[model samples]
Target: MQDIPELENCRLCEWQCGVNRLEGELGVCRIGRPKVASAVLHPAPPQSYTIFLSGCNFRCLGCQNWSIAHFPDTNETPRGYVEPECLGEEAYDVVNSREGKFLGADRIFFSGGSPTPSLPYVEQVVREARKIGDIKVNYDTNGFLTVDSLKRVIEFTDSITFDIKAYHDDVHRALTGAPVEPVLRNARYLAENAREKLWEFRILLIPKISVGEIKPLVDYISGIDPTLPLNFLAFRPNFVLENYKGASKELMEKAVRMAKEGGLENVDWSGRVGLPGRLSEKTSDKYENKGGEIAGGIAKEAGCVTHPRNCVACELEHECPIKNYRPAKKSI
Candidate 1:
């Protein structure tokens, strides 16, 4: 373990916890060694096996995978320890298997707990896997890794699925227990240097908690490259934020509209489209103008089908004017 290329004083993420993980010391990310929570063949995005690593650099209050991300590093056996050679061999077999090829599961995704903690191990897996098949690797990250680590990651992975939690420093720290500047730095660096390999950016709108984070976040990413695939995910209340309601369809639609207004060319959203308020994203479905016919009366008067009461909080409220309307008029 001491011989592994672990940072003497860890500087993997912006936290710079500097705890020397090679000696089996824990930092805020809380993993002394590279540990994986689970590995499953995800039959989506052209099929891939997703390795969910344990421990996260940022302790997000609303994290859905807290059990895994915030788990104790006491027993690595539960959190499987697959060395590069064996893990890579398994991955190669999985991808090249008849079932894998038929199902289009030709890639591997290294996800987290923010993959930053397990980056060295992940890279090793990528190297070993390539020996068997030229398997593409998708690195799913929270965008908090240091610029140097990100460059090394880009060397092995084919694409990145990055997450942007918020734009400002204070809000980000309050929400994720980390500052936002490091995320922004890595984002811009990736855009400037590895733009083509940036597969997509994922943003979660945490209803009342993080509604304020969407616009500025969108503006910054749009500035970098509007063509970059930006996906807005609806937040499901979980972990510390379990009491709060999930995001709404109306909220997501407003978000989509704002993203378009911010000059983002490739924009989309995922989650269920249910009633006007307090909707849940647990229902997996693409966004649709399902509320188009339901728009009328209050909805028409507010120039929105949802007629959401959080007007001041909504960045798009100014785009619509209040006016008396005839019946059956629906504004999407």
Candidate 2:
């Protein structure tokens, strides 16, 4: 952990707990040392060697990579910490391999439950990789990072895939146990200030859950820059929302249409569509906000005790039921 000094009094993200992760004081992320959940030569757009980092700041209800995100809280084990130098060399070698070229690989992609928790470690890895040879790097984020963190991310990353869960604060909190303000702030900062490094903005369409958010979110992004790339991903239920209905193909098409009509010039959609499940009963009264009542209801059913779902402020954050939850169903 000495290689990444930020762990001493980490403020890498908005929580700013100031805990010494190096000496075992845990913050909201609960990650002591950076660890690699897994690494793969992915075939997705901007194909490259994708490194899945362990742990996350957000306890999202619909996380597809819960096994990696929830980490030690869950039964799944990760490929623990590797020296940044070694991992960097491996990333460079693999991305330049013949198999990589055949698959159109051209960069090293940092993805996780959210990469902000491991920002310092990621910088070390990139530094070591560049010593071997210049390598393009892409960062996939939920956009909950602080202004300083966002600036650091923009400094090293060649591209960024940003996720916007909801436009409304209540809905964002209900869905991810965090406020939407910081995410929105970071999104606007990237679009207005560092547009060149941005790859695209990704919004997951979760049947009825995210539909109401689409129009408002679209308007917000188009307001920043109508030409910024945006992609609506069809949701396949996982994590606490494992039993919820997945987004249908028709829903995704509708989202694209809505974005286009809302004035986004570069709108698109992706991901597997129409996996089976039933929408849970809405418990709007559980939350004060009406925007994400259904999502709030689902979180309530899954044992999230906090109203409005502020993880950073919740007294039960360390022993979060949502973090410990093991869903019986996984649509993906």
Candidate 3:
């Protein structure tokens, strides 16, 4: 592991809050140095195997991981503070568990409030994870990263899930307190360089606010490359924005149609409205009782399910994680 300064202060993202992360220096994201809420080799609600990181750059008022992303102090006490080497060891152990052994996931996802903000540490983790296993690292980001930093980590990542909060600059700024230019630039760069690496562009469709915004964004993405997979996310009110209503079924459909109309192909409407996955179900009785267990079981089963249709027809499949399913047992 590269031994650099102890991140006495970090300015990795747009926030540029040069506070010493190691010394528990609180920044806008409300995090003190390498604070990780939880790290486990679990099947994500989206049905994909993932490793989650904590901390962020922007302060979206409606952040789902408010505890981890917005207020890092509210949760469990911070544990052994170490460098990226420690994270790598932890990740290896998680991914190699009995369940991880079954999935044999080549992909290691870097997810968080805004992973870009912690590029230094994240890159360290990715470098270490790669050495331990033949893994294709992926970044789940808000696309607010600096181009320089983005380029640095791009080498370590095989693919990226870039979030375009809104197409319209004003709306984007309003929703994320940031402009859309950086996101657009990063998306274009990634598409140009990693076109064949499964660059899934996602946009959260919020009620009323995202209707007009969808068309322009879709049009922009279509211009980028019609084959680029566009995922229209169904916004849910989970954390700080509990009072805000979720995107209605109608609105989500309209957004999907708009993407198609904008000339984008390979669009996946399975996020919520079209196909119901463990993460997408809002109030189904089946989901209420079995969603958590099913999600857990699927992850544990690893390499046991195949075919996207199974996920599509399962009544709980929203964004199947295994790409084109390989093979595995049914959820226990």
Best-performing candidate as measured by TM-score: 2
Candidate 1 on 1-332: residue-level lDDT in tens?
21456655777876676778777665667667777788878875636888888877765655766666665632323446778888888888887788778778868888877789778888888888988768888988898888889999888888888888777555564456465788899988988899988888888886654577778888898888888888888876555444446678888999999999999999989865442334332211111112111112223333432222222233332242221112131211
Candidate 3, residues 1-332, lDDT tens digits: the string is 34336366666665556777666665555455554556655554232246555666654434565555543534434343446777776676666667776765545677766666566777777777667776667778898776777777677777778888776555554445455688898888888877866568888875555666787788888898888998888876543334345666787777778788889987865444322222322221221223222322333233313211122133222222322222222111
Best by lDDT: 2
RMSD of each: 12.8, 1.2, 13.8
Model 2 earns a TM-score of 0.97
Q: Candidate 1: which stretches are off by over 4 Å?
A: 1-3, 44-46, 73-77, 273-332
Specify the poorest-scoring 10-residue window by lDDT in model 2: 282-291
lDDT (Cα, tens digit) per residue for candidate 2, span 207-305: 777878999999999999999999999899798888888889999999999999999999999988888888888665755545489889888887888
Residue 80, candidate 3: C-alpha displacement in angstroms: 5.6
Better of 1 and 3 by lDDT: 1
lDDT of 2 at 282: 64
lDDT of predicted model 2: 0.89
Stretches of candidate 3 above 4 Å error?
A: 1-9, 18-27, 45-49, 73-83, 101-104, 271-332
In Å, residue 201's CA in model 3 sits off its true spot by 0.7
